[model samples]
Target: MPRPHGFSYEIRNDTSVHITHQGRAAATLRAGRAAAFLAEVENGDAQLVMARWTGSYKFGNERTARNHPRNRR
Candidate 1:
């Protein structure tokens, strides 16, 4: 799959992480979750990490599912 793009985050008063996708609000991580996100994001691909944190990452199943018998037109 193509690398995830258009994902960005902002830290609010050192208390939360606000994630956005293509300029729209996606999710907000608070307290412990925000702390964990900060740690992981600093060590990995930020875009991919944000996508995952927002539950938007692909699991490589779209193509297979689209071609399955039940989905065929």
Candidate 2:
């Protein structure tokens, strides 16, 4: 199946997490706390920090008028 347009995942430092459509850091957990992390994300209580790294797609999601809203065109 195709991936959801507004949902994505990130793998960082051995942790994998699902983020929301707004690019807000939804949840994070240690390798051993995968379930806990997901629980937080799902429970709407996680305060995950926005990820900062080179090549993150978050930049592309910003409201930039330089290109098409969806494709950065």
Q: Best by TM-score, which number?
A: 1
Candidate 1 per-residue lDDT, tens place, 1-73, comes to 7788999999999699999999999999999999999999999999999998998878888999999999999
RMSD to native, candidate 2: 9.9
Off by over 4 Å in 2: 1-5, 14-20, 35-73
Q: Report the number of the highest-lDDT candidate.
A: 1
Task: Report the alpha-carbon TM-score of model 1 versus the true structure.
Answer: 0.83
**Total clashing pairs for each candidate:** 0, 2
Q: Which stretches of candidate 1 lie over 4 Å from their true place?
A: none
